[model samples]
Target: MSATRVLTLNVWGRGSAWRRRLPLIRDGLVRIAPDLVGLQEVWRKRSGCQAERIADGLGYHVTYGAASSRRGCATQGNALLTREPVARYDVLPLPVPDGVEPRSVLRAEVGATTVLVTHLTWEWEHASVRHQQVRFLADLTHLAERRGGRDVVLLADLNAAPDTDEIRWLTGRMADAWVSAGSGPGHTYTPANGFARKAREPARRIDFVLSAGPRAVHAELAFTTPVRARRRTAWPSDHFGVVCDLTSDPGAP
Candidate 1:
């Protein structure tokens, strides 16, 4: 089986200097050149989707799934980018409780593998809601495994800390790339980020790359550099990205 390099990140939608950040995002992605990329908070307009804009001239097959809509634009959601051709694509809408934003998972079939991308509810008080969403994702993964018998890579900006019940529940079932291979705290959401500081969230590793059938070999944070432009400094997004290398797990079920 072929090895896969996976990257997962939350693009922060169109918030806070997105126009300036988009160029840096494109450049950073070009350098990393991941085999598969899962993006959350991607914005789409009448003109085109953010996935298409990033995939432009990059040779990646793009699939986007809308989770919510903005007033002036069409929608915003999760997206999957595969370097190879995708055999199939599907979108699964997730549960949306009262006062919570919509969310969905983007699924792509590449060769013999299945990749699922999603973003869960963000508020710290929304743990219960995230729990439900995690259950849904777990079911989806199991169903896909039964249907395809293919390797599965689940990527997301889950918005929960590592020690949180939702995260613990998930890592117990699947291999968390960062836990297995990353050094240091592996905090993706840091107060050091100019864009993230406004959110008042403490430094935490809420984003994840998980695999059921692939062995995580190495993992690191990406797009951590802050770029100064037009008298302002910003990282590619409010959250850093997780990049991981995965090899097929021969004994995986």
Candidate 2:
């Protein structure tokens, strides 16, 4: 089948930066014009909703699955955006220990693919929690395949490094876009944390695009978005965006 272009990003729905970064984020998406997007940390305040505004303005279809709302975003959660109309969608709440922020996965179907968007727990020290989450995801993916489904593509901010067990669990079941077709470190996180820009910490490629299916094969890492601003020196969010192109076997699932 023809290739599909997908983008995934964590929009950093917290703090005062949201207002400042909207323009840059909008422009970034417009430039990429991806066929589909799996966004984490999408916000919805009384003034406006991040996904709605972007979708309505750019003519992309959107579906949101909320997990919490400090909600700076009344419906703070994961969002799946597609240039084409979604044939179906599902939102599943993920398991998380009490006190940790709730997590959820937003799944959608467009054309011959099943796309899942999610944001997992962020504690680097809490590998156990991440592992449990990955197991659940693996099981869910298997269930879909058994039930007869198209290629499944998982896009998320996993918060786990490539070499980490949590990521290994996922990569073992699905192909990592970066590993299959990418160069450089593929770092996605960039936290300032009130420190000088470069002094805070180095970036990490916690974000990922993974796939598994009889037809899921030959993935090309299109590029990663910078999210930098023309008006402001700061980035749209603390995370970089990933874009990947995938060619599926037309005769297979």
After superposition, which runs of candidate 2 have C-alpha atoms over 4 Å from their true positions?
A: 71-73, 191-199, 214-231, 250-253
For candidate 1, the clash count comes to 0
Cα lDDT, all candidates: 0.88, 0.76
As a whole number from 0 to 100, the lDDT of residue 147 in candidate 1 is 85
Residue clash pairs of candidate 1: none
lDDT string for model 2 (82-102, tens) is: 888999888888889988888
What C-alpha lDDT, on a 0 to 100 scale, does residue 43 get in candidate 2?
Answer: 77
Candidate 1 structure lDDT: 0.88
TM-score versus the correct structure, for each prediction: 0.95, 0.86
State each model's C-alpha RMSD to the native. 2.2, 3.5
Model 2 residue 58 distance off true place after TM-score fit, in angstroms? 1.4
